[model samples]
Target: MSKKHRREEDDEHPDESWLLPYSDLMTLLLALFIVLYAASSVNISKLEELSHAFDNAFSSGINILDKNALIKATDEQNKHQQQRHEDVGARPNKEQLKQEEQENLENLKKKLDSYIKQNGLSTQLQTQLNQSQLLITIRDNALFPSGSADVKPDAQKLAVAIGQMLQSYPDYEVIVSGHTDNEPINTQEFASNWELSSKRAINFMKILLQNPAFDPKKFSAIGYGEYRPVDTNNTAEGRAKNRRVEVSILRKYTDTATDDTVLDAIAAQDQKDASTASP
Candidate 1:
């Protein structure tokens, strides 16, 4: 009877097999909470390591936490975004640089114009500041004789003054171009207009380079002969205008069509003025 009573007592208690799964669920929930808390402070790599450890310990191989991967992806995205911001901040803006360059050219032009007007050189020389260059046009009579390539002794002073002014701008490239009228020439020294124009350009450039402040490597001489005339070759006055020398200081920030557009406008204006004065 006692044995029967013990069996009844054992049957009165319930089976506890469900506690095994319940305990496992509770442990997983605790691990998830810990991972979530740590993820708020740590990088993605550490979270991934912790996830692997939890997966190994559980032995069920069931993926209980996908939030770690999500957090890792978010972290990587933020890192890339910050890097892009830094890159953008480090570089200079293109439009700002262009504006600064334009201002610098304008100031230089003002200085040159003031010097020319003060010295009463308006008739013999003129300066034009355009998008691609600063052009200084000089009448041939001011620098050379009627049929010679040699620069006059007194004209050396003009070159010296120009050189002094140019000393302030050491970074520019200066091009000295010689132009002539359509009249052909055959001298003992020069066989053709091309040779005369080229020699004239070279001689004038040499005088400018005499200043110690001028960089010889930055200067060049070219002759367009009668091809690049600013005026007509039909009359004596036009021919006189055509026979000239041009000193071009090339700009550092040049645009593709800006130079041509500005030059064409200036040339058109000059042509209109010349035509108006002709008759």
Candidate 2:
């Protein structure tokens, strides 16, 4: 009975197991896993590159990049901008300076013209007006005796008059220049025209300095013997013209208009005074 029971139990357990569904399920799962793996692995490196590119594009302009290309480009742009700023900063305004210069020159011109006309020195002295400055020309004969560097007594009066006029505007500078003809001088006092001319300029300068209104710091003497002649040296008339002294009033940059408006105003006032006194 025990053997029979054991046989029956074994026979019952041995009932053919239905393993097809289980096997099929396991195979199908393996196939699905394989398909998933293949799809995921396809172009894995390319996908990673694209992701990094997208991140970079979105991150742009937030901060400066340390990459070689970005750094080089940024440096170039900065250099260009810096250069532009320097160019603009270096240029001074032009119109303002010109206007100031004109104004100052006009004032000097009016005063000089009036002096020449009033003293009946028009024949021996003249004033030239130009864009840059005013020049007062004095004939050599009127300033010194023949072959002498000393300023004549009459010349001293003229110098005093000029000094007084200059005192009214102490800000301007006075340039006394001496000019001579081609005639050579051989004397104990002056070996050549150069010496004579320079001495004459110095003498005139001294006379100007004697005046209380004259400032020595504002005066300078220059000698241009036989050079810078306004006329030809070959003729007597030209030589006479060439042998002269010129007192130039330099135009200040600030007095022209915007820069030199002060000078211009002075000049305009001098002109007005002359017109009022004219016959």
Candidate 3:
């Protein structure tokens, strides 16, 4: 009776071994579903947190989850890189800037020439464009009286017109330079040609600055006096040519070289003056 009862118990149990694998399969399926759900959101931070948790829980780190997170991060980085490239492509390059600036200066020169010709003031005013700058030269008699540093009332119109024209190029550096003949001057107002020339340059520059369109920081005034002469002061015609004012619109590309040349000329003149005075 005992033996028969034991056999019945064994038959009733009927190999509970299958339950172990079925439970394991259910657990694996649950984990896989959780991983798939996390991946669908594409939140790298959350994925990284989950990966770290899995790494702590298991001896071997969560290699599969880490790989998915890396892929997501790479995709995002690539998207940002592509956007940056497009943005850079939309902006003007250095060569384009140079070309545009050159065009602007050329157009400005043409307008000035047209105005000078139309007003029949070509004899008094002249414009020349070179590699380093666009120079506008005005005879001293056109803007001032004999031995006077003040600008004539009629010349104010010319100054105003020039100031208006310069409004288009606010970025350019403007230099107003005053020059004089080698004739010695000793007046009550001006002690010498140096003071006369300097005052003239400052006064003219102030007139241009009155337009409010010009940047004060970009504008400067200097006096060369009898030095840096374009013509010899031996003849009446040469002296007339030497006594003038120059408005220079310096080029951005050659500004450094232009400045160096001016400095060198001034130094050389100073040395010559010192040598002449020593004797």
Best by the TM-score measure: 3
Per-residue accuracy of model 2 over 1-279 as CA lDDT, tens digit each:
999999999988885566888896686577547545644754554344434543664577322223664465446656866887899888766667666667656776788789888889998998886544578899999999988988898999998887777666677778999988878889999988888889989999888788776678989999877656666666789789989998887766532344466567667765764443233
Record all residue pairs in model 1 with backbone atoms less than 3 Å apart, i.e. clashing.
none
**Which candidate would rank higher by TM-score, 1 or 2?**
1
**Local distance difference test values of all predictions, in order:** 0.82, 0.75, 0.83
RMSD of every prediction? 9.7, 20.4, 9.9
Candidate 1, 134-159: lDDT as tens digits: 88999999999898988988788888
Q: Which candidate is the best by lDDT?
A: 3
**Model 3: what TM-score?**
0.69
lDDT of 1 at 18: 100
Write down the TM-score of every candidate.
0.63, 0.55, 0.69
**Which ten contiguous residues of candidate 3 have the minimum total lDDT?**
56-65
Candidate 2's C-alpha runs over 4 A off are 1-101, 254-279
lDDT of 3 by residue, 37-62 (tens): 86687666556655655665466644
